[model samples]
Target: MVQHIRLVGIEASDKQALGYTELAHGIPHIEGEFGDVLRRSHAELIGLCAFIFRRQTPLTTEWLRQADNLLDRKLDELQRLPASHPLDQTGVILPGGNRSSYPLRWAELLGEILHPLLYRYRSELLQAPIEPYFGSYR
Candidate 1:
């Protein structure tokens, strides 16, 4: 548990450092099964927008929770699993009574999820302070 938290922090720092480069190159465009790429890019843009607009509001942990929720939702869409499914090293998610300590890739999970959540809730998040102040309210 302790290591997991630290891993998340480390991954976040890396994301902040190489965010722009990642945005330019890491993501790709595709239709149908390529939705995940768009979702992540959207979330990344959300944080970038917030930074440009509100200098004071650090990206909220609420967004992180929402990203985690998004991962859960996506996994659910993939297939049915036990309440606590764990992804293997090769990204194979195993559910049920698999008593294995899941070695999750923090870089992929945290950095990716952060943006997807933000993109999904862009309206709810940006409408109040960002959009309204910028005169782009909807």
Candidate 2:
């Protein structure tokens, strides 16, 4: 929702998306395939949020800002990775405590980094039939 202008109450049209616009300010654009991936996944997640909203769940901009703060910080760190002359590698772990290699998105990387922090909210938000936003992380 950081990359969008509206969050709710807007009708989708050929010229307009449900709650999106070109005017994104929360996270500055990262160029190249990384930027494309961020934009696409953001669209997907916002669509997912809309689905949740339709199901009577509310997503707040303040929460979005919090999320954006983390993302901005991470991306800023990542951007500095190429400049800081530090050697940090990313290794993906497998299902059974093994390790594997897979090329993926930084947004997903953000999710991985933030998921634990977000899980702390489940106790406050989860009830009845709604599952936690994310199940136990792998």
Candidate 3:
């Protein structure tokens, strides 16, 4: 995913890279092939955000707030899943036998990177131009 993002000349943060790596590794326990699908989907979103950030436009606080709200909803949904669900499983066995919630943690980390940019971009990101590189998951 970092390589994909770098193809567009954007250097992803260490947190973003680590989060995605953890997400990819953690997802298989829940849904096998689906993990790859999510990894690709998230990479697209991450690339898009990087592209938008690279544009350096001044964004409105309201837009940022809306973005954050959307991410919050996503986080809430992930957290609300039943413990037995594969999506909720982190595959990490702790010292006390507790499984880690790394998937949710990764999503939260992604939100951290995106939410702040809401107030930073002045114009809506024009995806058409960068669609070739950061468009739908391949």
> Which predicted model would earn the best lDDT?
1
Candidate 1 residues 1-138, lDDT tens each? 001112222224312211111233333233355356564454334323233222223345555566677667567543543334433423453565445333344344554555544454443332112321335442
Tens digits of per-residue lDDT for model 2 on 33-128? 755554444322322212222222233333456667665766755565432211123444545564433333433443433223222222222111
In TM-score terms, candidate 2 sits at 0.25
lDDT preference between candidates 1 and 2, better one: 1
Estimated TM-score for each candidate: 0.29, 0.25, 0.25
Q: Which parts of model 2 have CA positions greater than 4 angstroms off?
A: 1-51, 54-59, 80-126, 130-138
Model 3 misplacement above 4 A: 1-63, 70-91, 101-138
> Residue 79, candidate 1: how far off, in angstroms?
27
The candidate scoring highest on TM-score is 1
lDDT of 3 by residue, 1-138 (tens): 133322333234312211111222322222456444545444233232333343222343444566577657667655654344344434556555777554454344444444334212212222222433334642
Arranged by TM-score, best first: 1, 3, 2
What residue pairs clash in candidate 3, if any at all?
A: 57-122, 58-121, 58-122, 59-120, 59-121, 59-122, 64-118
User: Using alpha carbons, what is the TM-score of model 1?
Assistant: 0.29
For each candidate, how many residue pairs have backbone atoms clashing (under 3 Å)? 1, 0, 7
